[model samples]
Target: MKLLIVGGTQFLGRAIVTAAVAAGHEVTLFNRGQTGTGLFPDLEKLKGDRSTGDYAALQGRVFDAVIDVCAYYPRAVRELLAAVETKHFTLISTISVYASNEQLGQDESAELHTLTDPNTEEITGETYGGLKVLCEQAAIEMLPGNVLIVRSGLIMGANDHTQRFPYWTQRIARGGRVIVPPALDDAIQMIDARDEAEWVIAKV
Candidate 1:
């Protein structure tokens, strides 16, 4: 299968690309070419800027599946879907879309966080999840049954730029009194980058 991956330079995207390659599928990465440009030298790279809506480079190109990893707003996703409506679209959504303080083992059917204004430009950390919920809804509307929404939890592995879990991992590696946040053992679940990659590949 030929796959088009948006934002395939960073941690999770890189892992998905690697997994797709390992699975013997043709993979093309679409990004601004600012991060991990030196990593996948042999792979096909389609450069574009999502913030400024510069997707002219992707015109007339189609793929078996398009995995969107960097879209944060409804308009961003809407533009991409309008450009590539023929492909099976897989969106990388966050588990944070679920309402805060979720029940154990929530699935895709779980209630999502509320969004007052989906197109608002002032999206802060408090509104990230709600905005994502809006984005997911737009994706579903655009792609319908052809859309696969992979709700992911904390993603961690090499090449992680966020430094969220890696910080904790490094702290734990030191083997000292780690000042962890409250509810350290409260049923935390994380998806390894490789696992997420494999899952996406299989689904696609």
Candidate 2:
């Protein structure tokens, strides 16, 4: 199978690419070529920015599955489908889409955050989840039954550039007592990028 990955250079995106390639699938990456440029030296890299409507590189290209790992806005999702032709569309969504996180064992059917202003494209911490929700909707609207969305939680693993989770692990290695959250039980939920990548590849 031929897989086209959007933003296949950082964190979870990089993991998906590696997993897909290891699974004997032909992988093609589409990104702005800004970060993680040194990685995946042997694969095909299509330089473009979906955020700014720069999908010219993806024109006429078709794939078995299009794994979008970095769509922040619904507008970008719309632009993406218009640019690439693919049989299946997979979106790497976040758990942040939930309207409330206090509930335990919530599934994808849980209420999702809503975007206050639909026309605004500005992405900030407050709008991130809402924008992602919109992104999911956009894909579903375009592909109907051909879209799959993975509501991923905090992704942490090797090649994670954020380093927020790694900071705690590194501190623990230094032989120092670390402060943990007051709600210890089920206070945290995270998925490793590599593990998620493997699952995504299998599904694709």
Candidate 3:
């Protein structure tokens, strides 16, 4: 299958690209060429700025499936959908779309954030999840039944810049007095970048 991965240069996106290539699928990456430009030299790279709404690089391109990893607003998703019409569209959404973080083990049926007041600038934990919810909704409306929204938990692995779980892993590896959060025993679910990539590729 031929796959197009938007924002396929950072941690999770890079992992998805690697997994897709390993699975014997043709993969193309579309991004602003600011991150991981040196990596994945063998794969196709299309340059465009999302913030300025510049998608001229994808003028006459199409793919079997598209995996969006950097979309944070409904307008951005709408622009992408208009640029490329594909058979399948996958979105890398967050599990925080649920109304409250207190809710655990939530599935796709959880409540989503409103796009009316989405955060356009810097996205905090709260705003990021909310905007993602809106972005997912836009993609669903644009692609309808062909959309596959993968609401991911904390994504971690090598090349992770977030350093949320990596900080814990490093602390545990150092073997010292680790400061536990208030809810230490709370079930914290996470998906490895590779595993998430494999799942998305399989679905595609």
Instruction: Point out the worst 10-residue segment of candidate 2 by lDDT.
Output: 180-189
lDDT by residue for model 2 over 85-179, one digit each (tens)? Answer: 99999999988899997888898789999977977788898888899999999999999999989999888889888997888888889886778
Best by lDDT: 2
Better of 1 and 3 by lDDT: 3
Q: Which residue pairs show backbone clashes in model 1?
A: none
- Model 3 agreement with the true structure over 21-71: per-residue lDDT tens digits: 999999899999998889999988998888888989888888999999988
Residue 145, candidate 3: Cα error in Å is 1.1
List residue ranges in candidate 1 displaced over 4 A. 172-176, 182-185
Q: Indicate the residue-level lDDT of 124 in model 3.
A: 78
Please give the clash total of every predicted structure, in order: 0, 0, 0
Mind giving the per-residue lDDT tens digits that candidate 1 earns over 1-204?
888889888889889888889999888888998998797788889888878888888888878889998778788888887776456898998887899655877777788898677568456887888888888889989988888888888888778889987787788898979887797677666778988889988988
Better of 1 and 2 by lDDT: 2
Structural similarity to truth (TM-score) of each candidate: 0.91, 0.94, 0.90
Candidates sorted on TM-score, descending = 2, 1, 3
RMSD of 3: 2.0
